[model samples]
Target: MNLPELLYALALQHVPNLGDSTARKLIRHCGSAEAVFREKKQNLLKLNGIGKTRIANLQHTAHLKAAEEELKFIEKNGIGVAYFRDQDYPEKLKHCFDGPLLLFYRGNINLQKKKLISIVGTRNITGHGAAFCEELIAGLAPLDPVIVSGFAYGVDITAQRAAVKHGLQTVGCLAHGLNQIYPKAHRKYMAGIEENGGFFTDFWSTDKFDRNNFLKRNRIIAGLSEATIVIESAEKGGSLVTADLANSYNREVFAVPGRPGDIYSKGCNDLIKSQNAHVLTSAADLVYILNWELPSTERAVQKQLFVSLEPEEEIIAEYLQNMGKAELDLIALNCKYPTFKAASVLLNMELKGLIRPLPGKLFELV
Candidate 1:
């Protein structure tokens, strides 16, 4: 977008009641943000869902002035800007109904990766949670998946630091503006994070820091990824909110289970029990559920041809090979195994790269 268009888009974003969805509606009807301002009120009122109250603040000159100042700050700081409709915007986030109208970013970040997962959890992370967060990232390193997090304390920082250590690109979704970093203690890690990945936010430099901002920020963390993983969470927390948002967006959600009596395990356990999230015991679970296949070269090096399988696995494999593709229960019944036992065997075979799972509970040889 050019200077005038960017200024107008920013001004549209500044209007109080004109949310991202409404702004998009106006922009599409009028052809552009600049054109939206030039459009007459009567014609604008003819459109659906555009009420007087929503556009009441559209004519305010103060918005333009604010946008100009923000544009100056963006130019001065060399920050990157992505309009919602632009090709440069995060593809997954663009599908979100309430994604920001504009996103400001810093560092060498790339949103085009095929496999992106968000890892979120409680601020008061337990030692087991922290260890799991690191181990999970390390295990996922071979896939070169992008790690995204809230950039706050506990699980978020642990995941990002692990991503950096594993030489994987990681994105930090911030609650505040690009001009500042929250929890000042994390300032030291910024350079390392920016070295490979970077930060993303929609809040302007002048926006106030508020607790509600974190909730709003949660949407971006969820929207940017193909899946959201909760390493740990208490009964009530922001990570659960992110998980809900991910589910709302029709994306996959996974949670690491803990003992029944543990306080931090309550949220994850509830999600699994309620079937809102899949049980994530290791990276293999994610790899299997998402059906992510390694590159041919990597597979050649990692998987041995004619490798031996357990007697039961060999039975399941022979059945799938002959059947082409079979549903879970059919395979179990034909092979004389219980449904649950057959499902577990299928998962292990998938992790071993021996067979693959299909949608609708179907399985087949690789």
Candidate 2:
């Protein structure tokens, strides 16, 4: 977007009562944000969901003034701006009904043709949770998926650091703005994170750091990814909220199960019990559920090369190859192996790229 269009979009975003969806509606109706300002109040009111009060709010001069100042900040800092209607806007996020109309970002972030997943959990992470989060990212390194999180403490930082360690891009969706980093201590990790990915937020530099900002920021974390994974969450926490948001968007949600009595495990356990999220045991589960497969050429070459598998894995693989496709229990029963053992073998084969998993617990030789 040009300077004038950006200015109008910023001004429209500055309107207090006019939310992202309504602003988008008005922009679509008026052809442009610049045109929306020139539209008659009576005509804007005629649009469904736009009230007289909202039109009156749009008439305020203060919004434009604030937007002008924000534009100056963008120009001075070399910050990147993405308008919702532009091709550069996040494609997955575009599907979100309440996604930000404009996003301001800083860093060398790229999402094109990249697998994206958001990992979120409680700020007070447990040792097991941290280990699981790190291992999950490391295991997923082969897929080179983009890791997104809030850039907060505990699970968020753990996941991002693991992403950087694995040479994967990681995006930190901040609750505030690029002007500052929350938790203050995480400022040290910023350089490494920006080297591959960077921070994103819709809040302006001048916006205050409020507790409520995190809830609004959670949507971006959930919306930016193809799936949202909860490493660990308490019964009531922001991570659970993000999971809910991902489900609302009709995207996949995964949760790491904990012992029934564990405090941090309650939320994830609840989500799984309620069928709101899939049981996430390892990176293989995500790859399976998302149907992410290696290139057909690569699979064909691997299959022809006689790649080695464990004796048990070979038994399951041989069954799958002959049977076409089979579910977990069926494969175990036909192979005369225990169901738990068969599940583990399938996951290993998936990680090795020797087999592909389908929906409904089905597996087939790649």
Candidate 3:
């Protein structure tokens, strides 16, 4: 990882009142993350938009603790993780305006190897939506591109599991630390994915599950993918949130038509009608849109790794994979376990050297 991106990433986490524009100003003046941390308040004021509050809010401690915590969690889980500066970080995400400062990961898949397309839909999915997801995934499976999703119960899980079943690498973006898999039951396939595909997340290990995280998580899912496909969404559903983010990022967003009287169909219909999303009726539409090629055996193998972790072990691995580090509580939230139990597992795992303990109560995959 480069010093500039690393420092900027860490520093940005602590920089309050530092909107995108202010952040750019700080970066421009400091020339690098290391330089920014080295500068005094007066020096920061020279930047065009920086103010006293934002400067005061630029405490490196929070960022450092968060970064180190993330690293610790990952080390403990035995999963591989990467930040923006890491060579393995996916290229599609790096250019996004609000791309994550860091990304935790797991599995044997190559982040740099495959092209990405995100598929998303409602948590309360309809039959038509489910059909759309299955058919689309099966169609795209032969092409061998990486499928990206939020790992939410509906279309996201369907797309990811479908890709896995078809022997394609699928990346599921999470709203929480990788310490545990969300929705719990999905761990079976998530473990399967780690052996082949992978997972990614941006939050620190200490952050608890909250409403805001999903909104933030969606951006990366959209930004990381070359394009996004909406299988189904209500008029105001989470899937559309991803579509809007994809559009704001200037990425393509697609929606499938639903039958009339379906409440879940309203979102898709409105998007198509408003011309917010492209009407995608088939995998061919994606193929034509993205110009993807079918993957050879060599390419597919390069995208994923066979897993050795047990189902529960992989749950912890997923947490570390997403945030690169985590605390007991965060792991519990993701895994749906009590914090005390998560601690016991962490202790056992740490003893095995699958993960390493960090200062300030964090653990990361080794």
Top candidate on lDDT is: 2
Q: Could you give candidate 3's per-residue lDDT for residues 73-137 as a string of tens digits?
A: 65678755566555777887777878775677777767566678899989887766776677677
lDDT of 1 by residue, 1-366 (tens): 788889999999888877888998899899998999999988998988888886668888999999999999999999999998899999999999998889899999876755899999998899888877876776677788999999999999999999999999999999999989998999999999999999999999999999999999999999999999999998999999999999999999999999999999999999999999999866767877898876655455433678779898899988987899998879989999745456656755665677776878787887
lDDT at position 300, candidate 1: 50
True-vs-predicted CA distance for residue 357, candidate 2, Å: 7.4
lDDT of 2 by residue, 1-366 (tens): 999999999999999988999999999999999999999988998998999889999999999999999999999999999999989899999999999999999999999998999999999999889877876776677678999999999899999999999999999999997888898999999999999999999999999999999999999999999999999999999999999999999999999999999999999999999999999877767877898975454444455467777898778877987899998889878999645456666766766777887878888988
Error of 1 at 60 (Å): 0.7
Q: Please report how far candidate 3 places residue 359 from its true position, in Å.
A: 64
Error of 2 at 124 (Å): 1.3
Better of 2 and 3 by lDDT: 2
**Segments in model 1 whose C-alpha atoms lie over 4 Å from true places:** 302-366
TM-score of 1: 0.84
Model 1 residue 59 CA deviation (Å) reads 0.7
Better of 1 and 2 by lDDT: 2
lDDT of 1: 0.88
Please rank every candidate by lDDT, starting with the best. Answer: 2, 1, 3
For each candidate in turn, the TM-score is: 0.84, 0.86, 0.73
RMSD of 1: 6.4
